[model samples]
Target: MITRRMLLGTMVAAPAAACAHSLTEPEYPRVGAVERLDPRLDAIIAPDAPIEVLATGYSWAEGPTWVDRGGYLLFSDPPNNVVHRWQPGVGAAPFLKPSGLAGPIPAAVREAGANGLDIDRQGRLVMADSGTRAIARVDLATKQKTLLATRYQGKRFNSPNDLVISRTGAIYFSDPPYGFSAFDESPLRELLFNGVYRLAPDGSVALLDDSHHRPNGIGLSPDERTLYLALSDEKRPQVLAYSLDAYGMPTGAPRLFLDMSEGLAAGRPGLPDGLKVDSAGHVFATGPGGVHICTPEGDLLGIVATGKAVANCALGGPNGRDLFLTSHDMLARVRLSRPA
Candidate 1:
């Protein structure tokens, strides 16, 4: 029952006499600073943007989604099997318990909870329910979950990790073996390969790609002409972009978008996990070192370094300029120049 307010109190308990600051003191505890790579980053991020830590101590926070209707943020802590809601003024609280599995915890899974979340066109919460190995939709009012897709061809998914929804109501998601305690070698794993899939509005599931060893995060470009996939493979941490056909299917092989090998070698804590595209087509992808901001052309602009393994990010706020991060054990946020 640890709430955000409790964590905040513990984090900012310093004596005023010992740490006095000017009127410009930040309201929250700031963990990291913005790493500006290109001069263009100045246009996207303020020169003094601080990575403000909002909450601490989650099992493994992931899948941040901004609920515009309620003006709140929702994110998943997979290992704890909970979804938390963070509001601007009220702070963070548990929004759903048993956020993934309703039954007894299964021995096969290491983390039996939802990993990714997004709001559908109808404003219902859609989730990558790793506990059930399926993609499901959640009704906000009654907290009811309806399974959308559970299997592909005839095999159960290893685990649905992350997802993005197209304007046409198509749900594009990634399935990897992260949920399994033994990973790909787990006896419970049904799929031979990790895959990126598309769940059509007609309830049919289509396999987009199965080449990636660990496809973790998924996103669509603002124009919706390209789809981005993040490979969490430690050896080849990178992002790939695929050209989508008019039918909303990938038309050709994916091309390299951003490589995080150098950052990984430098000992950055995170792998490429979750990402989001801004209204102006800029990409904010979580990778080694923090969240990497890049242009549509894949030029590196900057990094929102959280000093921890960042798992996911979402854009929202009263003005849609706030970038919320779900770091490994805490939640943080930074203000962006552009809207999401």
Candidate 2:
């Protein structure tokens, strides 16, 4: 029952107050200062949600997912190849190191694949692995991993970038050519186009779609009837939406969900990567300058003004009111008006 508005009543800090000028102040006139990086996003959320700095100082954080059980937020710092945990009152902690590989693998090559993560319907931690090109399970008790999927059409996936477990345990993930071996004699391997895939409970891998140039972020609609994904490749950069059938299978033609490159502050350093949704359906997506707020209808509400090309985010803290974020080299948080 914790909502974002309730958490903000206690005051939230902007991600970087040093570079952000609060519009709440009268002297700071709107003077086109509020940039909606994606032109299509201009109508997504709302322009008034005040942003505040939360936490900071990390290195290239990605893959943020919430763990309501532990009352903390978790995200991956890829360059460091580790997962970090954060709670509102107690601060951040080293939740897990050398996050396990999905399939049978050697210890030396295991840690390299840990990347995207999610909480399965069973309340267990699940993740996508670039190091191993597979999706895996993390037993809350022993932290043992059970491989879910890693191959399709007799070929290994390039990398499992991001994933989501449906209410029924169905697994969907994005595959890109970012996890292959570089003649390093590493055990990691990859194949196939940078695609979006689905893993059935029986370990069957389905190529959901391949239209994306390089899909980096993926999420389901609040109603579970649509698939929203981000294409990191500037050639086809966009937040695309796909219609789904009753079984949650994606069908029909995909459409431009949000062409961020045409947005207010389009020319920035980063591309869309990781994203999360709230119970009420608002999407907090990573953008060049910070987090971009979007309405369920794919309209842009506004930006959170993190002052960094935020990599990803998740809802945690007491009641999911805390917005945990990972910028290029920093981890931070803030109170929002919506809970995830």
Candidate 3:
């Protein structure tokens, strides 16, 4: 990724009604640095690689994923109820209007759009929809949405925040009350506890854990033997790993994968928010100070410090070597030596 001031400069120089219609690789200005904490990071990322800005001016951007078939990236702007598409040469554009909320949102709702996104085995876009309080599937070509799960034991979910799909067609996700204005205290909240759940292929939803105050991001190891959860709890910010059975069910208690209390204590800008695992098992998690790159054993190797709160990230590009990040208002990317 390279930095370019000329593209943004030209857009500013243009008259209000005169916008460029040409599609070319838009080189955006770069911000942040690759902070190497261990020599092992050299094998994953280039120490001098730049974090190139792809887009900006979003209202709480989250849930980024790459569409390999489309050769582009899609991310959420929750508060604005929009899903944006970003391409190498075209930059950012709205992919879906009313990305989650189709009508007026509840007065107490803070965010009313889709949060986390992933492609299922069938190539359909699966979403953790905070507005509809469910896990949904969207047809990429028609934009038709199908709500897969909205309730558990007859009670509506607080809000489905993030999700990951297993090879067996099962879906794992986290439910928190971040969509509500008062979070857990909001009147709109139905579930008494924030939970991590699994939706099996048979349309059954099972609770994995209900103790985490707020579990935000969910991912799986390359082998799908462990589930990695990122806790957004500021009081106990950390990443947790849970062993999974062959059926993709949690088989045991969770273990601490990485503790971020020290990073928070050091006055970093973000909490453990979203995460992803590379093919080689490295965990690239968005936590205190930015994206923390760690090993399977929970050793931090480096960080992609964005100087802002990064919400989510996705591995995409021609060879899945591009690390796309949704950093608050901006969308940025870093070229990685190792593909996800």
Candidate 4:
């Protein structure tokens, strides 16, 4: 069994070679394999498109999102507690410092930073601030930060990990123990179960599901009729799909979307974490070796293997066809045939 210290060390401890190298550039070649299982994948991903390493040297980079208004990509390096921005002509630079943990913190604490990020309908930056244990919004124009939700039923959340906003202004998020130094055993924990919740436009928080052992990534279908969640448990790594009603409440039992048991048993690098859906209803979930591309019905279509443990990805660019990935220590990108 992996102890808390061991898990934290595995995540934040940089390899000797990586620590010796410069953070401005990648240490390895920009190369990865694309496993094509269906012909339909050819229509989405170009056969010749290469995965390019944009930058490197981070202590667990995750939560990638694109700002269309600024034509830049923003992602978080949690262990470092900083957010970085990458653009076309200009390269990567720190956009925000103390990105997640605001005030004083213990020196031994780790993993205190922002995780998932998204742009709301108002163009404000919405973040799942694990350090703050709240879902907050940042106004780009004013640089002001405001807390959206902090507790459920008067109990403080363990940590808000990832979230997605609906067209109606409702927010769906997952509360997991990843932000805590000791994870589930952390004394800061309050809630009995890790839950997936919905913060409605009416300013009410509702529990959607608490069955997932370690809910991490979440996304909604293009039609907004289905909700997809990724459970980041090594023993039971999988993605589940739930049907939603007009009110956005889940209906009936969730269907098993994709399972990675075989891959995990084979010693693959990652578990189901963050995920996103395209206009075509294809799910691009970060799991196993890299990004797993599957149809809405859960049929595996292809895999984008970055040869590293990837955390999350976002679809953006001039036409929204550029796929930006936040791998373990590097930021990579790949061009898609069709726009996301």
Q: TM-scores of the models, in the given order?
A: 0.92, 0.78, 0.92, 0.91
Which residue pairs in model 1 clash with each other?
none
lDDT of 4 at 308: 77
Q: Order of all candidates by TM-score, from best down to worst?
A: 3, 1, 4, 2
Model 2 misplaced stretches (Cα beyond 4 Å)? 1-57, 100-113, 181-190, 263-266
Candidate 3 residue-wise lDDT, 1-340, digit = tens: 1100111010112231122223456667999999999999999998899999988898778999887666677899888989988767667899888888788887998789999999886668899999889999998888999999999998999889999999998999999888887788899877899999999888999999999987989999999999999998777888999999888888889999999888877877788888999889999999878899999999999999888888889997756799999988899999998777
lDDT of 2 by residue, 192-276 (tens): 3578987888778888887665677888877888788877665555788889899878778788877667542465646677777
lDDT of 3: 0.86
C-alpha-based local distance difference test score of model 1: 0.86
Query: Higher-TM-score candidate among 1 and 4?
Result: 1
lDDT of 2: 0.64
Write candidate 1's Cα lDDT for 1-340 as tens digits. 3211121110122243123221233388888899999999988998588879888889888999987666678999988899998767557899988889877987878789898999987778999999889999998777889999999999999989999999999999999888887788899988899999999999999999999888989999987999999988877789999999999998989999999999988877788889999888899999888899999999999999877888889988656889999988899999987776
Q: Identify the superior model by lDDT, candidate 3 or candidate 4.
A: 3
Which candidate should be chosen as best, given TM-score against the real structure?
3
lDDT leaderboard ranking: 1, 3, 4, 2
Which scores better on TM-score, 1 or 3?
3
User: Model 4: what TM-score?
Assistant: 0.91
Q: Which window of 10 residues has the lowest lDDT sum in candidate 3?
A: 2-11
Better of 2 and 3 by lDDT: 3
Q: Which ten residues in a row have the lowest lDDT in candidate 1?
A: 3-12
